[model samples]
Target: MSVLYALAGLLIIAAVVSLVLSLLGVIVVGALRILPVVFVVLAAVFFLSGGRIDVHLPDKWRRK
Candidate 1:
């Protein structure tokens, strides 16, 4: 639990630093760089919450 908190804190700090650096124009932040991080953060939150996302589709889409 402590480790998880520590990791989450570090991620927050890193995000803050990245935002600051982006504002400073020291580095260019683009979708390519942003997406994986967003995915990772969302996945982590979802995993910690033990939540499931269910997608419903039409029967046509379910068939090959």
Candidate 2:
């Protein structure tokens, strides 16, 4: 009947919406989990390069 068709259509639409939301949620969570790792890597690099936060200039930029 017409009511059955409407219900089926609604169900399909809901399923699609749920799928999209779940995918986005997964992507966001994955990025959040990696954020700490990225920060740790940055800290390691900074410490390895010495305590100074200044940038090293290239030969062309340095005055004689």
Candidate 3:
């Protein structure tokens, strides 16, 4: 009975860890998948506007 309890605890821990890992993996994969689309859209906007767009960033960002 003690061994069964231990096994159950381990399984629960493993499931939690796997769930967290899968969530992180999904976020990373989603970001990677969307990156190309984002770039393409940005490029299209830039080209369509004849490169006349001005991007303004905050001072903190400008410092970086």
Candidate 4:
């Protein structure tokens, strides 16, 4: 749980930084380059967690 949150946070930070850099023309990371990073991160999460993940939904969204 904490690990997933941390990983997600890091990915979001990296994406924001990447976007900022691209806008500044410091680095040109097009969509093609970004896709691999997303896939790799997803693969890492799935593999490292042994493909088991539990998601909890709020009561408001749950089926009665």
Q: Compose the digit string of candidate 2's lDDT tens values, residues 1-64.
A: 9999999999999999999999999999999999999999999998998867778889998888
Residues 29-60 of candidate 1 have per-residue lDDT tens digits of: 56667889999999999989998889889998
Q: lDDT at 46 for candidate 4? A: 91
Q: Which regions in candidate 1 have their CA more than 4 angstroms from the true location?
A: 26-64
Worst 10 residues of 1 by lDDT: 24-33
Q: Write the per-residue lDDT of candidate 3 for residues 1-61, one digit (tens) a residue.
A: 9999999999999999999999999999999999999999999999998887688888887
Compared with the true structure, the alpha-carbon lDDT of candidate 2 equals 0.95
The deviation in Å at residue 16 for candidate 2 is: 0.6
The lDDT for every candidate, in the order shown, is 0.87, 0.95, 0.95, 0.86
- Backbone clashes for every candidate come to 0, 0, 0, 0
- For all predicted structures, in order, the TM-scores are 0.40, 0.61, 0.57, 0.40
lDDT of 1: 0.87
Structure candidate 4, residue pairs in collision: none
Q: Where is model 4 more than 4 Å wrong at Cα?
A: 26-64
Off by over 4 Å in 2: 42-64
**For model 4, where is the 10-residue window of minimal lDDT?**
24-33
Error of 1 at 61 (Å): 83
User: Given candidate 2, what's the lDDT at residue 1?
Assistant: 100
What is the RMSD of candidate 2? 5.3
